[model samples]
Target: MADTTADGVERRLPTDEARELLALVRDIAHREIAPHAAEEEAAGRFPRALFALLSRSGLLGLPYDPEYGGGGQPYEVYLQVLEELAAARLTVGLGVSVHTLSCHALAGFGTEEQRAAHLPAMLGGGLLGAYCLSEPSAGSDAAALRTRAVREADGGWVIDGTKAWITHGGIADFCTVMARTGGPGARGVTAFLVPGDAPGLSAAPPERKMGMKGSPTAQLHFDGVRVGGDRLLGAEGQGFAIALDALDSGRLGIAACAVGLAQAALDAAVSYARERRQFGRPIGDFQGLRFLLADMATAVEAGRALYLEAARLRDEGRAFGRCAAMAKLFCTDAVMRVTTDAVQVLGGYGYTADFPVERYLREAKMLQIVEGTNQIQRVVIARHLVGPESR
Candidate 1:
């Protein structure tokens, strides 16, 4: 049951197992996800049941180690799965990516004891997670965050402050939180694993978003929330580094999602063009529409290639941050263009709720803003090319 792309872009999967995994993903996406996307999104319904289904199917932990109940698949394979999910619905794909990001600190830097205690449940026990880094005042300047975690005499910590724009905020089971434990700047930060139901830890109402209403984005408040010393992830003052590492991988996820979104838009436009007759012939027969479709298809393929190249570099243990940033910038921008063209091809119907293109157009805007905005990505790429800008 191999899936075929309308654009004829060949996926270079590493093994038979990867191909089988992709087939399963596509089947689940088309059957369970795509069919309900529009209705659920319109109702602002968060699909917790679908997430449980994904967890039970071993789709939640593909990029993690099998020792902790994960599938132990490579990033390339995992990202392609994300693409399939995003093509079905952005809420599901981005939710998985955020869950992965939430688990990163403990998986990559936790002690043996901590990993033994938590990784199994987080990876496969149906627990959903969130990453808490950005605060009310520290969106782009993440290091300037004011969330504070203070040590107590009994080897415990008390955390206080608010985290803004948190995905899955109210419903997540656990959160990986970054708080200031020292003086100032990036080096002052420390990471901790906090239980969602901890005393004084609560979430504000979800945001009234323009798109992705099916996914909750809210602010989490920590009002003297307490945790044991063992909850500290990695060493104190190393939280910022851990966050940056997680973001490098997360950017690749965003790039893959953007490519999937563009692919979906292109498919919709091509199908509409081939069916809708304008002047005793299909609109697709017109040269003007044909060129638009060609450009849209080309952008989708190019975006896919860029993300896969970054994923390969990561799998091969090479320096790929610059590549990841480039992919995020280019692929998200491509989706913005591709989705807009899709709406154009659909004409007036595209602008209404009667078609999905308008929804895609709305969803595409968020990709350009998340996981570091496109402007920030360009700054990161420039730093790799000619070193950091002088202060």
Candidate 2:
């Protein structure tokens, strides 16, 4: 209900509740996260310890029901916390997002029996989970997934085939897997909770990736892995819809990460322009360069606005899928543009690992590809505007 002009002063500072929570996030990100980001990223290490710290800090379950050891914060607030973590390090933020996405099926549609059984470890962050919707054959066409889960004589199911591009694949305690159970297309799909260490469940070597290196990606092989009927999330034929719903939220998380990455890039660019000397003058003194910084900063703010708007819609329990797609497309492209220009603003220095800009550039790239590619986002937006029944 209140707004503030540019500069540190606020016409209305956040409410006491919001400010307190955001402060906690900032403290953790600046003190605990910023210090180790570069080193872990350089070493390509998955920070299992960092996740535990986040869990202890009450962040791992920030938007879930408190009955399950969660913080019960609104998505609007939770997303801001994610943004701050991402500004410090994209890997940890993305890992949190993936973990949250993995919890969606169980939380949204699971039976009371299922929730009671799984939500404690998941919401408590004692164990991490991966959402397995993408397969070797089904990246964007998720309904086309080829993996199968056949009912066995014992009334259990045996899962077969592989899931590709799974984040946290090697380290996740379990996976929310989608497999074919009926006829072809979306109607055939069912969701299963498959443990990572289950017999016949193995991860391929971590993928050689472009960025978010500290967050590993791999293929999960399921060679007749067995799961109880109780492990199935929701009823048969609902998995595809559930997967898309999860992504609607997951894409918003990616959008927030992009905003944070853009903000970090803008900060670096501003600092560099102010301090770096060019022709016996600060680069900030040059209007040509200063304008670029202005644009980057503007994009950062705009991206924030976009994600926050979508998040608010989500919190209101409104239809926000189209908004999520728009946020993902715009925010990630903005991050790419801003980080690339941040490098240009710093000249040769930005191109090197000596500064974080290069890393930011590399990191911004995956934001476009993950959580559905920007191209896919455009298609989603187009569909929503024209309506599915439209010609």
Candidate 3:
């Protein structure tokens, strides 16, 4: 509503359209998403209808081309939209990110015919998507995944393996799955677009999560799941490259979510301090609390700026992987620290479900782990700067 981010920091949108889009996102977040977030998360309920609403609203395809039903927004604008959604509820924000990641392989590498046939539906037809890369044995080391996809007599592929920690594992309409197609290691990996209802495909019960309970994180079992040649995304050995490239952008999305979460926590702490009383005066009068809020505000602003910078690099068609990794690392880690302080600022109430700060506190840990862990992010940055270590 104000010409500012979720926090009070002024935002400089690229155009009037981008500003209006942000305002729309803000309005939807406040009225539709934030109100039900606490209740649904406590109940571990996924908001499927809301996702459909987002799809219809064109929020799901913000960064893609408008020719195929997308909004054609730049990465900078898209990342800010994610920030607003995340500030209201991490499940919705991160869900949209994962969906965008799922679309990357095909949108970036598929043939014109393939894009014509599928991209429009994926972008706006309310078809929720999941990304399957992680496995039981492979988490940070994604290149070590063992899911297999063997070409069959009909020229279709049979996918057989389990994908662990999949968001929207059970309910997605489509999935972008990376599986082994040749020899061992990353070179053997291939990306395939699989229909959710493919034969023998099944999902394990959702993992009981620390936070983001409203988002289904489960192991998806692709037991002889079959798809036509049309499903193959990119070349046979190009899947790993595609996956990594997608992560470079997805990491920025995660960074934006982290900043939003941190901003929400800071807002809660600031509000609590102002209204909360002690020693016959408002707690805001205390210098001890004042400095803590200042630090939290600073961290939120810094994280937001870092992620937006990376998004701008991506939008400019520049090499942004190093910056993306840095943003992911700093923003996720900063949210963890800032949210912890927010909980402390609320004293006893912060630890309880009575306050959203505790929820934000729990959600912060997941960001450090998802979309390549913060540890892996540092490795990415180091490798970008110093090259990989000798084997």
Candidate 4:
């Protein structure tokens, strides 16, 4: 809404059509989804109705080629949609992000035939998809995953082992499963598209999480789950590379979500600071509180700038992985800081569920952990800066 784009950077806003669509989506999210977020979150019930609305609106397929029933929107535009959705409810926002991540493997690696066969179902309906990468023994060290997929005589692969911390595990209609197919380690892993109804494919009960209670997380057990050869994504031994690439884009989405969450918290804080009286004046007028607002607002702007830079690099097909990781690390940390400070601004009210700042704090914590922890993000950034052979 302002000329806030960084210097020497092209301030590219969304096209007219995209702006209109975004407005519509934001309106729907605020009017329809935001109102029920607290109730559904407190009840720990998934927002099926919200997702049905999103799917019908063709948001599930944004950023994909329109020929496949996708919105054919740019990643930059699609990410803003995610941000708006997240401001209404983190559960729906993160769920959509994970679903988009799950679709990444197929869209990026699947053959034409595979795209024709699977993209429609994934993009057209309310069916959700899970990304199976983290195992119980391996979270950040993805190379240590134990799930295996052995080739059968009929050219199908029999997958066996358990995948842990799988989002949408119990509810997804399909999953992009990463399993060890050759030997132990990252170089031996392979990706597969597993149907939810496949025999021997089942999920444990949803995990009890500290936040994001509405989205299901669980352990997915693959016991002799037979998947056809065509289900294999990309080449064998390429899973790690594909996974890493997907994460680069995924991290950008997380950064955008964090920005949105922080914005919501900041807006809430500002509104409260202005109305809540203290010392015969609104707290916002006090220099101390005003400086806090300044810092929060500044962090939001910086986070927004970093994520947008990463998106521009990605859109240009440049090496954006390092930048993406940087954005993820900085933005998530900004969110944690800003959201916590927001609660501070609200004083005791922030501590209670009476305000949304408390929920923002919980949601911010998960952003640091998922899509590779903030620690891993630093490592990614450092590695990019200092080559393997460098000191």
Candidate 5:
């Protein structure tokens, strides 16, 4: 059974250990993350040291196999930990999520020898990772990706392509990349584990964004980057399948981050409303503002519940792609609404950098676009409900 807090939110953690883990995450967030979030973000500094701390604390590999130095926690527990981190800083939360996504291909489909050789170092050895699936022309239609990997006479592969919108692109130690190996379309693709410093691999400058500037997003170019056959993650022509499978879980991670962001915005608004004087009393005492707070709180709770439901399904080894899409679509939409309302609650202060709501609003917009756009999510859900559309 889970526990209920004074804030009226019920955490449905399955074990006491999970509860303790959440408490530890909160302690870290309050002590180490929150205090530096605004400053680091404003300065556009990536907190590599903070990621090292998380890795040392066994947080960077929370949901993988314990044999590989992972914590072996379920997705439910892992995601709640993400929520706590995201509440402190979205850069940290989303960075962790992307790192985990980068590990999915090898962890799930690699040969035993490959897993034994790479999983431990990748999972908990202080090495960060990036996922390379989206390209300049293949954001929504991922099947149309044009990156090519040609096999060499020596059983090596030489890859050539550009991957765009890659989180942690320049800083990651490794990348799980997908590229064309055969014909056109998804069936031609294959997955590989590429070292970030491999010759011919380089990152373009990071994109200047509205928020989360502390996290780098850039385009990665594979200019004839070569890797041995041993680096192939799964069977040929299976890269698209592997990529979609990873995104199903990655969407849940994004959903958890969105809920955390919304919760943070709500907390900021409520705290300000309770102390800020309006006319003669606290602004929170007014029914109009109070109702707004109520709605924001409700949305946060609802989004959390939705993601947890999808996570539980994932942990049960059930098919959860549609649920994951729904959670991502709804939670991100909720964050945009809640953050905007939080700005309204703070009036002019929210619009300024003095308050974090403005930044929250900016960050919330990216969640709706990443993993998959909300429109793409709707198409996925509709396909699940009624079969694929006619060609």
Candidate 6:
């Protein structure tokens, strides 16, 4: 029953600090982010400066240890902040999520020296990061990644591979890259925190996406990209496990972003319903649109609660991978429905870019595909229920 602003849901935050932090985030979202989202998105401009602002605000590292210059907020609070940011602009919210995902490896597994050396600048010093795991062929089958990292005679590493679907691809200050170092398969993969300006690093042009045009997504290439031995994130041959753990948390971020998008669509639909009139009365007075609005609201509320439940489980140190998958699947699917319904509520007007629902609908589609597709999410959940597929 955490109090939400747009829908009037009640919130009981864990601490005064969290509540204040959320309030600050909401204010920033409303004032600084939302007003320019449409124009910026249409221009296909990435809001790198805004991310720097978030870093300065201590928002980029909320879920990590405070000792490493993070805010030390639990998933409960961090996800809610993402919800608010996403409601304003999917690019900003999802950008934060991707950045957080990029930082997960070192934060969760890096040695004290490694963390102390790099984390302070990463979390709050305005350095944007990207996660590099998905490859052109791998997709959901991460173990099938072909990117190779060979050990140098000096015990350093030289990576050679292309990482596809990378957010902030060309612009990131750092990348958490996974490359096969041993034999073929998951165990052979290892993680490294490579500088964005590393030797032989390059990026392809950003993909022309259907939505979230303000956030860049592209392929990154590492051609003999060199990194010192100190750049290794965790033990060698442990990258897949780390990647899976990061995805579990990243899924929750997606869920929160999905709920935010749905809420915004619901809000717009409701407002339009009350204002737009037919037969000399408000359209909302009609039973058909009224029921649709009701259903949309209910779906949004349910999605929000679902993600929060999963977040709470994560905060309590429970096994939440199954629940995270569920939340990602449900919330993203719900957003697609809610946004489509929002367009229906607006009728012809919704189809036009003059309104935001069309954009919301397009953006909702991306959630279904990222952080593992909805199909992949279902597979993850099914494995938890029935045990790792019949094969």
- Judging by lDDT against the true structure, name the best candidate: 5
Give the residue spans of candidate 1 off by over 4 A: 1-8
TM-score computed on alpha carbons, candidate 1 = 0.98
Count of clashing pairs, candidate 3: 0
lDDT of 4 by residue, 118-166 (tens): 9987886777888999999999999999999999998999999999999
Each model's lDDT comes to 0.94, 0.88, 0.93, 0.88, 0.95, 0.94
TM-score of each: 0.98, 0.96, 0.98, 0.96, 0.99, 0.98
> What is the Å distance of residue 368 in model 5 from its true position?
0.3
Worst lDDT 10-window in candidate 6: 1-10
Instruction: List, residue by residue over 1-391, the lDDT tens digit for candidate 2.
Output: 2433222422222356766777787788888888998888989998898798887777778788888777888888788878888999999888888998998898888998888888888878568889899988889888899999999888899999999999999899989999999999998999888887999999999999878889999999999899998989999888988888899999999998898888888888988888999799998999999889888888988888888889889989999999999999999999999999999998899999989999999999999999799999999999999866445
Model 1 per-residue lDDT tens digits across residues 1-391: 2445445657888888998899899889989999999999999998999999999999988999899988999998899999999999999999999998899999999998999899999999999999999988999899999999999999899999999999999999999999999999999999999998999999999999999999999999999999999999999999999999999999999999998888889889999999999879999999999999999998988988899899999999999999999999999999999999999999998899888999999999999998899999999999999999998
Query: In candidate 2, which residue pairs clash?
Result: none
In model 3, state the lDDT of residue 376: 93
Superposed by TM-score, candidate 4 places the C-alpha of residue 134 at a distance from the truth, in angstroms, of 0.3
Which of 2 and 5 is the better model by lDDT? Answer: 5
Q: Model 4 off-target regions past 4 Å?
A: 1-12, 389-391
How does residue 303 of candidate 4 score in lDDT?
Answer: 89
Q: Which segments of candidate 2 are over 4 A away from where they belong?
A: 1-15, 389-391
Steric overlap count per candidate? 0, 0, 0, 0, 0, 5
Model 4 clashing residue pairs (backbone): none
